[model samples]
Target: MDLIPPPAADDAAARAEVADRADAYAAAPLLNCLLREVAEPLPRADGSGDRRVYRLPGGRPLRVRGQRRPAEPEVFTAGNWQRIGHTELVKLVVEELVRHTGLSNHELPAEMIDSRDAVAALLTARARATPPEDPYLRSEQSLLTGHPHHPAPKARGGGPVAGWLPYAPEAHARFPLALLGLREDAVVEEGDTSALDTLGEAPPGYRLLPAHPWQLDLAARDLAPAFADGRLVRLGTTDFPAWPTAAIRTLYAPGRDLFLKFSLDVRITNDIRRLWRHDLLKLRRTDSAALSAFAAIDGPAAWLSDTGYRTADFAFEELAVLVRDGLRDRVLPGATPLLAAGLVEGFDGSPLDHAPDPAAWWEAYLAQVVPPALAAFADHGVVLEAHLQNTLVAVDAGGTPVQALFRDAEGVKLLPEVSRAAGWERLVYCLVVNHLTEVAAVLADRHPGLDPWPAVRRALSRHDLPEVAALLTAPTLPGKTNLLLRWTGADGADARYLPLPNPLVET
Candidate 1:
């Protein structure tokens, strides 16, 4: 019998580092939830003058101090204040939420602990891991504190660390895909899935389809029936490996110039990372809408179209695989495209890390990213989910942004299908609040006292959407209440946002 060894857990230095990293990793989302959903400001309580203190819903005063991310948590107890680690903070949050909302969630608190433990495993694995050579791949795998506002961004559906670390992108892990064949009569597909057919050869009577090996393992029990009945046959694995990008379910096969998105049952951040049937059915239409919208726009922005998909008829959503346009085909000539999320996360050799001129670089980035997203919403009625992960900025040799390419058709919303008003709101949240606000903050962080907001205001002012003028002057912007949403056990896709102080405002 063979066994898969657990992630490294013995080094003192690594253990100390994991403890530190785990605190930061786990605290961000918990803090976000606290501040966004429950915490109320109690001015000047920390005695540091500049530190902000907030009162938890349960009436405990918590003081925090840090930079560029979540601050260290210090709770008021026993007269003098004492610091609480991530685990205690989770407990504090659970207690506060129970008192605040009169709801005791058994599942969310467990997921919170799982998220923290997963971070420990990741930090341990990463301390001994080699980063990807390709800078783009490195950036795509750079999100350690993912979805800064979600309560459990790194939780692997409560699975053990060993079960997930083998495929974690943060650990710079890469592995070959598990290829399968669906019996010809049981195959269900739409659009250009020819890219998938080329991954490997199936038997004469079957069609080739590539899958993320992790997902195959997750769905193994459900798929056993088909495997036994000969409706599905194993065709071994890919000869070469595919790199898992920041979006854990999506893999980039550089050699083949292809991307394959699979059905992942784990809950990462907001939703269970599954390729749902409804999204798959409407994908071609939504992607076509985005493709046409980008084609009509005048700038260097490109849409990495989700060309097609393939799945088994018997288990459509569970066995789904989406084929998307890869970087080599869509990127501009002589330019290297980098993930925007990675830009914010910061990786080795990141163009943002060693930027020559911060303001100029930010301006160029805005030029490439802003106009097309606004235009897509206004002119073509295609509301792009232009959040950081879905957007890529390809820069020139000097690392000046020249092109912006967007992907993920499953997230794209069409015109009349969603009212123009609703589409604009979604676009504002994604493009402005979630995407640009983050990039601006990172750039500003790199260069102290350099306000990136004016440039953002300028870039947004140039857009003629009726919403633009009001957006530029709006006092409050919608901040998604991910913590409260999860605590209340609401459907992940049902986004409920509370008004946040709009950073774009000149205040």
Candidate 2:
């Protein structure tokens, strides 16, 4: 497949346009973090222009143009309002965070800047590239502003643009897999990895191991010795191309009907996108629990099992690639599965964006998404990481959501493994705070005065869990502190949350 179309070939005007958009796209999430985590909202004195004012940690008043996805940031400095670009915004954020948390993070500031530059590259590449014809692939690739509240969400490990753009989902990239023949002795695998053998042929006494090209590039040096010693042999790329999904490391092969996830060794948002040894060892148990939980529930909801993984023993974590169940049998027949995040981010054909009856559409959405998540928690003690990226909403012919399919066992947390209190908090943060809140805001914004939260309340109320009543009447909900978490250098999995006003409660 042709990748990225060579970045518009030195068009100065095009470059400027790309830069301007990248700035706006990049500023929204950083501003959200600064506003939510550190900056205090100041009451409107002269309520006008849909603009809200805020006080930064340094006591300087900041004003933004919009509420959801705030833009055109301005700071009150030198006795006048000064418009700040993404660069100035990053500097202002760093300064305020230093004052607010009394901690300095040089790396995060660089990452914030890198994230913006990465956006510029993506915008440039996307302009020259043709989007996928498949609406599912289009939804999978259309997350320009990911993780709405994450600081530096687009940072590609501060690597050169050329290094990552070819494989970037945002760039609508599709490429064939680089097949490797692993010596029988060097093969380290677990669970059902049978799907891998169908990718290509391997010589006698060797197993076929399909490798992600980007990962191979990232780990070439370390594996050089093994290749030289004949423990690994290159067998060339796959005939059919695999499209990279929203998760950069995971690629979907439509022809083969399989999903492959690899360790990227890049810091995307929070963690280093690596399939850690610890997580790999416990994959079967966690995935089995999720499978059992979903099987017990009688609904259109499904769990895309992380079937198994394969890797070289010498480069276990570095070359580890996970096999995930595809959308063939999991999704409801005749329904198209779209990434939930793409709905919030606004894709080309998102059902959420063009719903004729917004109210009914929202209720259908709530019905499909809410039940399975709550059932898993209440009935099976399985807390799914039902965040936007992990959830897929399959829409019927009328573009109404009919089913919800969840993935990523690596993020799943079992009940007995963690305290109920801790599991509940994590669930609330992932499901209610991260996922529902953003989708609700978008639905409300698109169709004004059509409240989405009431349907959400009704959906939660239908579930008879003890937590449901308390959740409905709760004063606040737990919101993950992504900015603070990164600032304090906390582990990505070690989530810390702050209380945000609960929208589930009836006013």
Candidate 3:
């Protein structure tokens, strides 16, 4: 008998641990959605101690071990509690949702499962891969369990792992862009697309077009004829590798100081991650408005403008690539720009983790982040999607936040296009609920007895907008219903929200 376990045994244990961690990672958001949307908290009649029990829509009692990231879910069945894994959790959620909504969804359960599998794949790949040296890039790639409340934040369209792994930001993936030469006549572009020409050389009659390799594979069937004809020709790949950011479809080329966002057909969170033709048509107007809004702002707050886009007329949405303003030009000097989501999710050098004075740090964060978003809405009628992923908080050498930069014109909404009430609700949801609330919760958790809400209340008090007063006094805030939205097959752009208790008022 061998005293030491074999390598195979060790490997099996490691894989099992990875799978278990993946299940926990995947279950938190699903549990959050179920509890938020359908589950009703039952009174502590039985003195359940630390365990919080909720009545499922199906009238069954379900218990969980924690809040924020709920875990160790068990259902009370036949007068006994049975622990459920990610698969069982999905089934339970599907049954409860069906009973609650009176609608059956075949797609969401698959997505939930796909999300868990994707997490397993990401964990495996991350263990073997080298994390980028740049803290910003590290921050960008840190979201292993993304969009903490979305049921399937990590889903990769249920595709094979190999199909999407090479381009996954969470896996710390970096790869060269597949360069293509598009015939001059087929090139449709707007704004300053001169940067595209600098990427690589094209023949006299052709223009250089850089494509995400994954996108190319996804659109191969649609672009076959163009490649066969003289309209499109393969020109190899870029000499340098591009770093994928938190937004999986967007890539950051460090050497060139450029961001190139490509159309991805896969469903990430609520929508198919594609650059729709409608969005492309309105890109100039929307991006220009954001640029103007940021320009008029008083502080160092900046907007990373989506300056232009280029794509083939024959396969417009399939191959469209947006040219976005890179960090070098816009970010404040002597400060490092970190993804707001990464700060919430956390990374090795996260400022939130190392803040010397959590209270002061919170104030500085609110000062940088809150003002610009409110000013944009009040002064310019440009409602920024100031959510975690869209916002970047730049910190000084001491890891204190000094500036805030917002991006993604595709999510921005102009004033009259949406009614002011609607825009204000969306803004509050994105800024307060999605961005600050998550950050505040993490901060409070890290430093116990630290009330982060007083500073938040103070921050809003400084903003004189009429909505600010009502916002502070309001009993509730609008929280988007991502799980139900996906289950009901609602349009991703159609944001339906439910009321969540207002922390500001409660505090």
**Each candidate's TM vs. the true structure?**
0.97, 0.98, 0.97
The number of the candidate with the highest TM-score is 2
Mind giving the per-residue lDDT tens digits that candidate 2 earns over 1-507? 454543446777877888899999999999999999887888864632577999988899999998889999998879777899999999899899999989999899999999999988888788778999989999999999987899899999988877888899999999999999999999999999999999889999899998888888888899999999999999999999999999999999999889999999899999999999999999999999999999999888999999999999999998889999999999988999999999899889888757899899988988999999999999999999999999999999999999999999999999889999899888998899999999999988888888888899989999887888999999999988999999999999888888899999899
TM-score of 3: 0.97
Extract clashing residue pairs from model 1: none
Q: Give per-residue lDDT, candidate 3, residue 264.
A: 95
Q: For candidate 1, write residues 399-447 as lDDT tens digits.
A: 8999999999999999899999888888888988788888887877778
What are the lDDT figures for the candidates, one per model? 0.86, 0.91, 0.91
User: Model 2: which ten-residue window has the lowest total lDDT?
Assistant: 1-10
Candidate 3, overall lDDT?
Answer: 0.91
Ranked by lDDT from best down, the candidates are 3, 2, 1
Cα lDDT of candidate 1 equals 0.86
Off-target runs (Cα >4 Å) in candidate 3 are: 1-10, 45-47
